[model samples]
Structure formats: C-alpha cells, structure tokens
Target: MSWAEVGQRWKLRLVQVDWYLCLGLLFLLLVVISLSMGAWKLNLIVNDADALPIEAVAIRGERARTSDEEIQVALQDLMKRSFFSADVNQVQDALEALPWVYQASVRREWPAKLKVYLVEQQVVAHWNGDAWLNIHGQIFDAPKRSDIGALPLLAGPEGQSKVVLTTYRQVSELLKINGFKLDSLSLSPRHAWHGSLDNGIMLELGREDKMARIQRFINVYPTLVKQSKPVAKVDLRYDTGLAVGWENAQKESQ
Candidate 1:
C-alpha cells in the first residue's frame, strides 16, 4: 500500500480502540449505579419501623411467683419497636427487676417474636423480718404475704446473708436429727450467733466453733429434758460445758 493510505488506516484503528474503552467504562458505571440502588433499597427495608413488628413474647421456664401482668408491664414499651430494633438486654433487665425473678434471658425468634426465659427466686427463709432469703443465700424483698410466715426467720447485718445462711443450714441439720426444728437464727453486730428452736428453747452460739457447740448441746439434750421444767435457754459459748436455764428461771451450769 501507499504511505498516506497506511497513515489513514492507523488513525481508524486508534478511533476503534477509543470507542471500545468508552463502552467498557459505561458498563462499569451502570453496574456500580445498580449496586448502589440495591443497597439503598435494602437499607430502607431493614430500617423501616413498621417492618417485622414483634407481636408476641413467649415466656418459658417454670414461673410460679412471676405473674403474667408483671411480665406485660415490663415488656409493654420495649416491644413496641420492630423486632430488629428491640434490645434483648433491655428486656432481660426489665424481667430481672421483678421481685420474684432471679434471672432472665431474652432472645429473638425468626420473623417477629421474642422468647423470654425467666428464673424465679426460690425463697427458703424470711430475712430480717421484712425481706426474704433465697436458697442461694441472696436477699430479695417481696410483699409480706400470709404464706411466708411459716418459713424460718434469719437475721444478720448487710452483706452477711451467705454466712448466716450457711450457719443456719448446718445448725438446723444437727438440730433436726434431735427432733428439733430451728425456727429463727440471728447474727449480732458483735459477730455472735443465736438461734431459737420450734419448742421455744433459745441457743446462744457465741462467736466461734458454732457447729461443735451445737453438737455439744445435742449430746446433753436428753439429760436436760429430764429436768422438771422445760429448758428455756442454753448458752453454748463455753469451751467444755454449757449453761442451762430452765423455763422456771432455774439456772444450772453443766
């Protein structure tokens, strides 16, 4: 071919390359725009307050003291939001705030529901006359109902519930073997321990070696009952022997 014809062919080839590059860039821009629109649409659906509304809360676990009305009250405002927006931790906190609820777990089921598992406090004794002590030695306050009057009474300073509870269990077990039921237990500010039996006999357990002291009382219990009057009180604070006070005010040192 001639030189001028070859130059013209080279210019045509360069124009074809530019057109292809433009088409490729246009396709990539279209893809990016489509992806952006899809993401925005998805965000609208996920964030819409009317979507995925929570309609019910399924409460599980054994519930005895926790009333239905109490659960409703705790969840009323929390469940108004969409399921995805609802905070499980907040729901759990509300349920656990109830007087009888010991622990609570909250979770979201598929679609639009909440599952709440609650654990109720198991009351074992009355604490300091107004509150209650659970089996775990935790103190919780509830209404003073007629049914709880029969439970054993335990008293102690703040933050000593576990200590008092442990001692009460140990002593009660020993006394129960001797045909006695521990009715009340108290720990003094001076760290002294005292207890009363169902039969109205008082025990002064003092500061230390309380279990050993109760054992000493059990050993001499049969001999003490032989007295003419019922024993009113027994002081087990001594190292080797205990003092007995009769119901008739007759006191003797064993």
Candidate 2:
C-alpha cells in the first residue's frame, strides 16, 4: 500500500525463506543420524562387545600371528555367549589397535554385512634390532627374517628408509635381475646412495643418474669376473666409466 508497508513485506518474505532453509538443514541432519545409528539391543548382539578382541580379528583376510591354540581360545570366548552388537567405529578402532595395522576404514555394507578394509604397516627399514618403520610413518616389530622376503633391505640410521628407497629404485633398474641381487642399500646424510651385493662387494652410486651408473656396472662386471680380476670396490661417482680398486694382487710384492 505505502513504501514503508512494501519494505516491511519484503523483510517478512526474506525471514520466511531463511526459516524454511534452516528447517531443511535440520531435517537432513536428523536423517543422517537415523541412518547411522544401530540398535545394539543393549550391547547384546556382538558377543564380547565393549571393545573388540584385537587379537582375534583377521583383517585383510589374514590369519592371526599367534598360535592355533590362541585362535581356539578366541573362538571359545566368542561362542560361549549370545548377541553383543557393535558399530562400525568400534570395529575400526579394534582394527587400528593391532600393531601391524597402519590405517583402517569401516563401513556398513547394508542389511547383512559391516565391511572392513585395512592397510597394514609395511616394513620400511630394519631399525636397530628386529623392528621396522612402516610406510605410514609408524613402527612395528618385524617378524623373523624367515617369515619375510622379497622385500628390499634398507640400511641406514633411523628414519633413513624413505631416502634409501628412492635411490635404490634408481640403481635397481640398470642391473640385470637374473644375475644380481641388491643385498642391502644405504644412504649418507648428504643423500649419497650405495648398495652391496651378496658376495660382499660394494657399489658406489653417486647422487644422480644412478640408473645409468648401475647399467655401467652391469656391462663391466662380467668382463672383470672372466679375467679372474675382481675389483674390491667399484666407484661410479665419476663421470666416465668407473674408478676401480683392485684386490691386492697376491704378486703386489713383485
């Protein structure tokens, strides 16, 4: 009717729109909470439900690291009781509690299943004794050597594994896979990388083009071995072929 009245009406319309949006957001939040919650039946559906049995979990479909007797004990505890239900977060926390699990994700897989996925800690390097720092930046005690192989052995001070692996990959490509094995890889503080062979010979691969340097070694190794002249240590830090140190000729006195 009047200018003031028109302005008042506009203000009222804006307030109504804001109220509806707020109501919509509140409804969405309620729906999410409803979908998320599980009726635990007073924690009765999941037997031994307060905290999961970490030792009993078989994440990534792997068998337990402990003995068969231990497994039987877990089964005994599981079966003697009735339903004790748990939520996905509880299961995830249980999985992460294990020493080897790096990180885990748990989700509801609908009416019947609660799915779990785990990324187990990897052996990055052997630290001092038998423990290894994994890829996820956590450390766990390593299994006996017999229990693991096909993994590169990283040697350096603590926390040097990531650096050594970077260099190892560069050098590893040049060598013929059938003829040689990378026994151990090491890195210096300045980031120099070197490796040893099973025969105890050392290889010096300077900071760059390590792949090319390794290839050069591959080309020269067979020829030296054939001549009955094995080099004590081979240095590829030079720009040209190689600087070789020889085993003292038994006839050095001559």
Candidate 3:
C-alpha cells in the first residue's frame, strides 16, 4: 500500500480506539455512580435503624374520672413501636376508647417524646337507668357515683337522646325564670313529655304544643302555688287552662 493510504488507515484506527475508550470510561463512570448511590442509600437505612427511641410520654387534660394510669395502660401497645413508626391516629383511637374520654389528640415531639391531649365527657344528665348524657347529648356508661345523683334524670326512646337533651335545656331555662328547677324529665314511648320539679311538683306536658302548654303553666304557676294546699300535679294538656291537683285535697274530700 502507498504511504498516503497507510496514513489514512492509521487515522481511522486511532479514531475507532478513541471512541471505544470514551464509551468504556462512560460505562465505568455510570457503574461508580450507581455503587455510590447504593452505598448512600444503605447508609441512610442503617442510620434510621438507630433513630431516637421514644423515651417519654406526656398526657394532658382535665381528668376527673379517667386516671393517668388508665391512659398509660391504653398507650402500652404504642410503646412497642419506635418513635418514627408510632402512629398518632392509633394513639388517639386508643385514648378515645376510654369510657370517659370524649376526644383525644396525639402528636410526636422531637427526638423521643409523645404528647397527648384528651377531652373528658361532660356529664349533663343521667340517661335511661344506666348511662349518662353529655352536653352534646351523647350517652355513655360510667360507674355509678353518689355525686351524680343531683343531675337531672332524662329518659326517651333510643336515638332520641339529643332531642330530649335539647328540650330539657330549653324547658329548664324557662323554668329557671319562674324560680323552678327541673329534677327529672322524661319522654314516653308515645312521645308524651313529663317533668318533675325540685319542689316535688310533677308537670304533665302532653304531646303536641307542649311548649305552649308549658308556657301556660308558667304564667299561672305563681297564683296556683299561692293556694292553701301544696301543688302535687299540674296537667298542662288543655288549650287555655291547666288542671291543678292539690296534695291531700283529694284525700280530704274522700
């Protein structure tokens, strides 16, 4: 071959070698980067294994019936989990499961701590014969206590707790204006309503226009209570008037 042809062939071989070298270096670079990334990911996972453990738990709330020991017992299951793995929602659910706890909030503090806040149920009245009613009319069962005897008794059909509670508040407030305090209120299965006052007087508020009936009784209460005999029962089922039953008066006539 001629010298010029030899030189051209050599140039072509050098160019091919240069291209192969570039490709090989690029492949090596990619391999190195992949290994480095894998090592970095592995290091991160290993470090997470040593993440701070939960060391302390703080519970905060107005606790009257539910004690701190009870709350701690509820959190026992959660204590098994790492600080990062523990779920706030699960904690809250556990706390709210307590009989007197109305609501619970849970949060994770930095490093190794958990914070919990709870709202206890506010007893508004005694429900049925076993449960107690909160201000929101939610019924919950709790251990019987003597201190709760003063709360007014409320009874109704299932699922009517809220309605009964609302009506009780309205009626009691109206009664308060007339210097009467409701001791107990009840709604019969047939929807009839009745109440007993603190003064031992029973009120019969029949269904339909019960509020108006009650208002009528309130308007005439002062005059009726001023009579010689103590009032025993006041039937407010009439349109314009109420039937007043005097204590011992029926026995005297007999």
Q: Considering every candidate listed, which one attains the maximal TM-score?
A: 1
Best by lDDT: 1
TM-score of 2: 0.55
Better of 1 and 3 by TM-score: 1
Alpha carbon lDDT of each predicted model: 0.90, 0.63, 0.88
List candidate 2 stretches off by more than 4 Å: 1-60, 64-91, 107-129, 133-140, 143-145, 156-160, 247-254
Model 3 agreement with the true structure over 1-254: per-residue lDDT tens digits: 89999999999999999999999999999999999999987666534524546788888888888987998899887877777777889999999999989999889898788998889999999999889999999999878866554899999999999999999998999889878899999999999999999998999999878778778888898898789899989998887888989989866877
- Whose lDDT is higher: candidate 2's or candidate 3's? 3
Q: Rank the candidates by lDDT, best first.
A: 1, 3, 2
lDDT of candidate 2 at residue 2, scale 0 to 100: 98
Model 1, span 1-254: residue lDDT tens: 99999999999999999999999999999999999999998777665657767878999999877889999998898877777888899999999999999999989998888998988988999999889999999999887666454889999999999999998999999889878899999999999999999989999999999999999998999999888888999999999999988877654443
Residue-level error in angstroms, candidate 3, position 182: 0.8
Candidate no. 3 TM-score: 0.77
Error of 3 at 192 (Å): 1.1
